[model samples]
Target chain A: MAKGGVAAERRRPHSHLREATVGYAFILPALVGIVALYLFPLIKTAYLSFTKTGVFGDSTFIGGANYANLVTDPTFGTALRSSAIYTVIVLLAIPISIVIAALIAQVRHGATLYRIAYFLPVVTLPVAVGMVWRFIYNGDFGLLNALLSLIGIDGKAWVADPTVAIFAVSAVGIWTSLGTAIIILGAGLQGIPQDLYEAASLDGAGPLRQFRSITLPLLTPSIFFVSVLSVIGSLQMFDLIYVMIGRNNPALSQSQTIVYLFYQKAFVEGNRGYGAAIAIALLLIIMALTAIQFRLQKRWVFYG
Target chain B: MGNTQPRHHQIIIHAVLGIGAVIMVAPFIWQILTTFKTVTESRAVPPTILPAVWSIAAYERFFTSVPLWSLLGMSLGVLVVRVGGQLVLCSLAAYGFARFRFPGRGLLFGVFLVMLMAPSQLFLISQFDLMKSLHLLDTLPAIAIPGMFSAFGTFLMRQAFIAIPKEFEEAARLDGANSWQLFWRILLPMTGPTLAALGVLTSLYSWNDLLWPLIVASNKHMTLPVGLSLLQGQYGTDYPTLMAGSLIASLPLIIVFVILQRQFFAGIASSGLKG
Candidate 1:
């Protein structure tokens, strides 16, 4: 109860250490937790990536050998390419989210219905969503094919065909993520005041004109946020690929994301060294892209 | 009046929303529909929209095949631990950062911000090794451990604590309340909404968490989603059974969402805004 200890321990100069002790004690658990789980692991993985690891988890440092192997690894190329394609496709959801969020923000009626309908996918188990979508994308006797037949078009093996597999899985990825993007954008939309629109309309501006000026400019921050999140999320895409295109599938090679490839090498093949290398590779790509986005944001991301 | 134009615009809005909603809702509707259909009907060339005979056969198979009760219990057990850990650890760390002026405060928090930025994949291999060393592999606790360390949750709660009016703490200090008392009684109680928000978000995440649990837990220790994934692998073509399993896996949260719709939406909105 040292009342005067506020503002950097003005009470007693000796009590600063005591005050800091209390602070350290308070943060000790979380600090220890992250140090153990996140920070230490990050360092350990980096160390392990350079080693030639054995199945027994023992390792000998081999200095860039794993990275060398990663360079030559053909599957790495496919994984990186698939990950990039998925991120690009999923980024489309932000524009889609903007329109939907704008519409939802405007309408007073059935807002709850629209929100809940979209949010269902967000809450559902990805494994389940992946399973159901795989069935729907089945070559024969699938709901998608059946619907296509109604429109007099035939459907191919969506998750099984190597050429179509990544796109098919990307579609599912986009579908599940729509709710999250919309929720963020919806909140962002709400922060844009109603009076701006009313004033714009009073000035005889069309709804589109008001949106182009007032809505879009103000919504840039949310759009940027969603894009960063989407890029990160899409790059880590694994659950749908694992569920929809199983480990044994011929299409697995074409559709696997970086995380999936990491899982394969680290877990399945017991090549922890290679997996660590892949993980580090993904981290570099993500850091580079996120940095670029942040750099680019000044040009477009409006604060007000 | 522009009222006529507004009414006309409303029709197109509803139509677009309605169409999108159908696309959004169809897979789930189909999952529910196909759950009741016989194998014959589910695999029919032109798929039937609704089941000719409504049946719980899929449910029966899913129940009888998987160790449903154990996995569900494991899911809940892990959920409670993970959520509890977030509330306690994040609150403590946030309180410390918000209220204190320690020597390494900024640097330590910078460490946390770095952790938050890196993807979960970066830590997986080493975390797996750590689990092995600790002999926690294939255990429900392993599924719960890495999740407990949440840089994101800490940052969120810290921001919440910072946003609290400083008057409460000053008043509490005047009453000779110590730091712990100030934290538990005066500060923590006021952060109820943020606490609830963190709890809800963490619960959703932990409940639906797949990859970590999928990696660590092999059998009886598998959480709900991991178990559901295995069920899919085993019953690949059995849409009915898979749908039933998937529905069961997702049911608890869906029910919670339906009941606490406002809070969940509020939680999502705030998490989106702050997060």
Candidate 2:
């Protein structure tokens, strides 16, 4: 469409110049924002990563010192592990969400209600979601414990216990993301030709058999998309952990992800250099993982 | 066999989804209930599902104690600038990319795509420095500036504009309409669904945004999320007040989602899978 428009405009050279000028004028603001806020900072982060931050947030070039520190830092290792675990745990939502989407698809009525109910967490502010969950996880008055006690079991301080805090936070990550995954998978399910299922039923295929043969194979593209996004989003988990687990919590160290670590180092401690390095590392990890997903997608994703 | 089995399947599906819905919405229901309960009842042993004596004291305290109104005002101001700016600017840029043969259009659009993948946190330190140098830190503009233009919005609009049949624009041009006139009169008015989708998503993002506003604004200038986070920090043990504050903070977006639920879901699905 655009090429045709351009080709026609090219017939009038003078008018073409005016059109190009208008084009530049139109894109100027977005261009400025992209350059100033995105491109420049991206480059600056790379540069800042090699420097040593001063007390006043100024940096002096220190030549891979921050990278070295990050490499040997036990805390960085722990954060890396926590983030990986969290990402994996959150990725579990993909299959769970697929099941829910499939179930909702099976129903003849009230699909909209199921979608809305699952999606409440997606729309609610993460801070609010975190707060509400925090109340539910409270050691004293938490609903989780209250329910557990009824079953002849006891509950610990879920978010405060170091061993379980990361898992607790990851559970929230899954719950919040389930809605988006369901919606994406539900759309994919809708796109499957109805006759394919009818044919399967004619062949005397059971529901589970039809799902395994028809649904899973056809739904790979959406699955790939949701998994890639969920991984990226999970790797960048900050607001939920920051709000739910909090700074003073005993499990803060164990629950902190890479982005949370970056926030603390750069913003709280004013160690801009180290923080920039962590952010860059995270950027590379996300890019690498996403690239891998895209490459691996060829094996599983059925474009048809 | 088929008919009876399917009825059984229907019952099982309804039972599963009904139970799942309860688990999903339980916290929200609890949050609402806790907002009206007194501190004592809110922390009652075994956790009372309903408040014995319903009172609005938590809401009253939240309003009186915190600068909830000003925080809301600041949040609204940021929302208007961010959403309005994104609509106008992203639409114009999308138009340019879609219809104009600029020299670096592909390259520039590529940069936008790259930025979409790069997390926003990478820019925090440098953007903060830029804000400080420009004297925007601790101000509403500071919160709004970086978010005013979104590459995602531009991309969505570009797709919308590209889907428009070229004949419409060709006819407009033949009628002696200039590029701006063509865009404003012909193309812009036709992208209602795309515009609505982008608007709803952008507002949802701006309303729920925490990290940027938390870092940029302080005290009276903080947005609702930042303010509510602070409330949690200060009143860590005050369940009722915190619940009340959180409810107030999240109510607007929830209401918006309820009203425009289809657009909201469409926006999420399209953005997630397509790009």
Candidate 3:
């Protein structure tokens, strides 16, 4: 059909407009869908965040009340702290992942096996990862506790204890994300010109010195990329806590992430207005943090 | 700088890599082994590497107890629709930006980028509200409609399409191929790797997604992840049975990653670098 159209267009000069119109026609479905579904909802959400509304379609204009409630809400504060802690702890995994990636790249044998092993957690469904980790973190018959007993160290109920619960969930965050970071960094490592390393070797540079002066600087782009993404992603943690911690768990208070709070308020509590406010606040925080990273990248993120 | 030093360095690298590999694989090994074990043996001290009573009880129970096959069918159906729609729509949008001049193109593309960066939660509440108003709630369309068009896919396909040399299109033009013919017959064939990569990514995301499905689909149209989570509520302490069910749910994604590791990395790496 397309070939037939081309042959017809060749005989007439007036069909160029028709051809260009077809190009626009091809994109119309997606454009219309995005506008109606995404853009309409986005603006409506912002409006609803500012207004007071109930489930019964009663909406009243209330300026700044929801945002005010967000500022003073105790749950919001706890969730913010949890989100910050989760972001920092999960970000620590990125550097750890880089070191592992560098090591894996140097191995000549069984690289494929190692790659598959490391990437298993990332490729698996998050619900599965959450459930598996929940089993491992169980207090009495959990594998971690059993292993700890063999070494004469008693393990606590990891995901149930308030003090350790956030860290427990963050561990899964790190574990699942390590594969992605490693793959990106490994690719960057491969792209580095080998001649530079050879030149450094001729200059009597040791392995540590070569890595410090060459690999670290050259890998900055991927490092920066992973850092920004990890931070943003960790700040929005919800699924693991939702599945692993359960709703009525004692440690739920300590490990409630911002998105989880949004879920509780919006769905569980039926405070759609308040939930929209928290979601907006989170969006602002993310946008600000990302903007700062972009601004700071001029100073440190080396493209080469 | 003799052969001895190089050998020593090689030894250090292997030792480091070997330890890292064990840590990465330990959890999966534990999960797989426990699935085959009986209830008591799985929880035993100094955990057994092999199940004492190797039986198909857990696997058999999983297939019999849960609506596992129906959930698998639901997930595959949604994945095919969503991925197919995304590929067709995103490629057309990409083509508009890549090959032709159009009005409001820059602003439209800017909206696409902003949609990419916007926190997914912000869109959820209103999207749900919209679905409710439209009477599409609790249906598969609620899940499929919102996800069918992705901004990230559009941006990625645009970059890939733009990277193709203009001479190919110009030569086609001289040969009397119009825009539709050029795109469909010539350009589309050349985008095999990018399209394959996008297909895999879209399917994986839609398959593994939990949140949106949890919000929209309740009983009839529940997806794999949502169904699996609900199953956890029903079967809490039975680790072996739970592991078997999860293993079944995750099998498709593992097969995908194994087959397309390179293309997956290329697609993800390109997007990450640009971001």
- Give me the candidate number with maximum TM-score: 1
Q: Candidate 2 regions off by >4 Å?
A: A1-15, A55-57, B1-5, B273-275
Comparing 1 and 2 on DockQ, the stronger one:
2
Q: Candidate 3: which stretches are off by over 4 Å?
A: A1-23, B1-5, B273-275
B93-177 in candidate 3: lDDT tens per residue? 8888787655667888899888888888888888888888988877778888888988888888898899899999999999999
Better of 2 and 3 by DockQ: 2
List the candidate numbers ranked by DockQ, top first: 2, 1, 3
Model 3: lDDT of residue A285:
97
**Docking model 1 quality class:** medium
The lDDT, on a scale of 0 to 1, for candidate 3 is: 0.83
Task: List, for all models, the DockQ compared with the true complex.
Answer: 0.65, 0.65, 0.48
The global Cα lDDT (0 to 1) of model 2 is 0.89
- Chain B alone, TM-score of each model? 0.94, 0.94, 0.92
Of the candidates shown, which would achieve the greatest DockQ relative to the real structure? 2
The best-first sequence of candidates by lDDT reads 2, 1, 3
2 against 3, candidate with superior lDDT: 2
Worst 10 residues of 2 chain A by lDDT: A51-60
lDDT of 1 by residue, B114-174 (tens): 9988989889887888898899999977899888879989998898899999998888889
